[model samples]
Target: MGGKHSVLGNSTLNQSPTIENIQAAYKEGDTSRAQELIKISCGENNRLRLEKHQLLSVAAGNGDLEAVQYLLKEGRVDLPREPTDENPAVVAAYYGHEDVVKELLDSLPGTNWIGLRRLQELDVSDNRLTEVPACFLHCFKSLRSFNVSRNKLKVFPDPWACPLVASLIEFPGFLSECLEVLFLNDNQLEAVPQSVCCLKSLNELYLSHNPGIRELPPELGQLSNLWQLDIEELNIGNIPAEVRKEGPSAVLAFLRAHLRKAEKCKLLKMIIVGPPRQGKSALLEALQTGKVPQMMQNETSIRTTKWELEKPSGVKDKMDSVEFNVWVIGGPASMSTVNQCFFTDKALYVVIWNLALGEEAVANLQSWLLNIEARAPNAAVVVVGTHLDLIDSKFRTERIATLRAYVLSVCRSPSGTRATGYPDITCKHLHEVSCKTLEGFDGLRRLLFQVSCNIKDMSNAATSQKLVGRLIPKSYLLLQAAVLAERLRRDLEDEVQYLTDLQLEQIIEQNPDSDIKDYEDLQTD
Candidate 1:
């Protein structure tokens, strides 16, 4: 374990990176061919598993479902390959290759594989799994960790109900009781089955897409061991006061209002601002959706028919690759509101709106910025100029140039990287169609999600620094808080620490501050 090299039979060999082969495949542009060569090489018995893994890397990058299938289906492919940093089955499932996964599993039984015992950390989210196979149920019993979110399932399998004597060649046995992390999100479940709740050992329960499961059985709360309980897409606008009073304010807020939280119990601040009629409401709708939020526009007016986006956990696991969330904010008139809301125990996010140019917008924005440093002094500000369709071409070009020049001069990384880290300068994205046309809207949504993630990163960095000064143990809470914070603030390296500390104190003082005590206890845990 101390040495870089490993013994492969009687010979000693230097360990080589599998990425080299993957890079070669990428350069060759024949991902399928690369996969074939990788399989043949790996089959050498003395071959490096890392090389085969590299082929998987290439396949995932190219989005080659066939190449991916080959790797997963390979009889020699290590199904439980040392659960290194990435779980192979989870990775395969995450990338949307259910057929290949099933084939791989089916082949396992033929070889008297007593089943994968080390598959506890497996997560098959956002895949194309239509039905829960018996093999999968058996897989989960062995899986201490599993995520089956964002797939096309109508009902969850009763793993416990699985016949104990079911033939391994057909239906695998019910998943064993060690199941811990279960993500059954974005599915078509209308009822919360008694069996699911009976899994008293379950910890994190993500029931985001069961919108029709209108009420949670108080019995669910009986699972006292549960830590994270996500039920975001239930479409219930207001939470009962009884639910709010049951737990700490931060946890209750997550359950009710869908407000972002820091993993380290630090403050979160965000600002949303955008121009008039630029699909801001549409953006909000998408952010609040369970799956990839579908966009709808009026045939006549530029107004959004519906708004208010609630971000649910585990929705992205249903997607093929990286997925994003949309955010919509108001124009200059709402700057005061945005600034005020930015002062919370959450990370800060700023959405800059592009006004059609005539409405007292420029003056209002300048005045708002003058006070932003004073009010929410620690927050990260992102300038998003929306409504490119309505702006004049000449004006758009000039504005982009000006914004690009400003960011490059100020926000450039120490390594002399471009402000956007791209060949281009300004981060501004342009779209032509009105929300009525729904044109270029998907691109816009993707762009906003990208920005949101950046902001979130920044927020997390700030929280991480503060954690070093806190008494809390750096557990998953710190990691999750850091993740949530990062999603709100992309880079906290630029944040003013002293200001964050001062603002956090003020935010706590604004309320009865009972949540502060609860969080303090959580930190001790």
Candidate 2:
């Protein structure tokens, strides 16, 4: 064991710092800052009262061999020979700094590095660490409290076990044996890794404020030691009251009983077409946010939103959280052809017309119908009649019925909705809604979610029933997020209309957020 000497702290010091600060500074390659903080951080005022050996540990963790060399000069600092946090070698090994570990051991003549096999506490939080490197995860066989929170971590490493550790004891369960506290909050994480279930000794988990993080693994219920669980703001909204507001016991019990379901988050193009202020954007806003959309005239809007469905009081795993790439084609008649470019068979279309326009409303509807028929035939369409509030309540039902009949006639006949010979399109349902009163929006929303997820009522189902939805792997979704993030970043730097096939491939291949490298199952949605 290293002797606790007052050599470094023997002089008067101005500041004290926790080990967390040193590790964070080192991680960001702020060597000078770490040195400055460490120099003044001497006495027992902080969590880590830095003495000679602990100061050497900071240098070793940072892979600063020169600092380690200067610190270890001629009994100025005690060299730790034990497996405790005082050991510079263990600190170096925890950060995968083999070079520093070797130099520290070599400096002590006959001394060999005693690795961190039973290190109780490790906190590398407040850094921009994108990953918990597998090599670093290997040696901490007895890691009690681990904190890598407040980092830009998107995903946990695969094979959550280190190869070196795997040969001795089973990987995942080994670390979980003593990992009592885990803080993985405030990251870009999309899905909570299922491997977290391996943490049998995990007592408290802080997973909140992660905007992209949607699904919580049901297997987390297996954590018998978990007393506190904080999960909030998943996908579009907060978790259910029972799970979120209740005690940890209630939350875990709920998760334990909760059935596992994977609604592989579907994304579709939701095209809203209309001329001028017909509440096309309003309809979309109401559907996505469950709030009234302000009626702005002829505004070009393109937005993306998650379909927030109420989850049962149980485990949370991507519950019907479909992402819609909403595109609003709102303009005058001259932009009709340009708008047609957005139409697609896979898209869920909503054609809007101001009911108060009378003959002009019918003509506008007809024109939009023609464009849809020409460009995107047999696509799922929902015809919407806006300005229902303007129509007198006494005649609301009758007026709606009249407009619905006209839409029906247009779709059924081979004749054009106006000209001639217009065949029946895939016009599923027509709903009239008033943007002002927010009437008939519930019906509109219900229909949109239904068609978006391909949910239909089926009677007399079998035991093993095949589900319906645009299901994609969690990997695909993560990849898409990465791609989109990169694309947006590029747009901010330099706006471009389109990306070539080769350019898109480069984006996917270069994405560090996703582990998926294969293009076989890659979806460019």
User: Which number leads on lDDT?
Assistant: 2
Best by TM-score: 2
Writing each residue's lDDT as its tens digit, candidate 2 over 1-525 gives 212221123222222344457656776888887766655554335434345566776677567887777677632576655666446665565454656766666766543234556577777666566767654566577888877777787867665623333234234567877889988888777766666777888898888877787666656766877888877655523234634554556556445434222233455667788887777777767766677776554565444444554422333334445456677877666676776777765677778888887655776677777777667655567778888889888987787777776667666644435334332444457777877778887776666666655532122121111123433444555556767787788789897747787887676666455434432435432
Q: What is the clash count for each candidate, in the order shown?
A: 38, 8
Candidate 1 TM-score over all chains jointly:
0.31
Give lDDT tens digits, candidate 1, residues 1-525: 111112121122232544455546656786656666666665677766765654554454345666666676762555553433243443444444445445545545454234355556765565566556544445444666767677776654554332334222122324325666778788776655445555557777887877767765433544545667777766534445434333332233333222222222322223444444444455445333423336554422112222222223433422222222222334445454653443332233344445454334434444444344445444455444444557566687676565444444443455656333222223453222234334444554555444333333223331222211122223334444544564456445665333355554444454452254434433322
- Candidate 1, residue 185: CA error in Å? 5.4
For candidate 2, list the clashing residue pairs, or say none.
414-421, 414-422, 415-420, 415-421, 415-422, 416-420, 416-421, 416-422
Model 2 misplacement above 4 A: 1-263, 294-298, 301-321, 414-428, 455-468, 473-475, 511-525
lDDT by candidate, in order shown = 0.46, 0.62
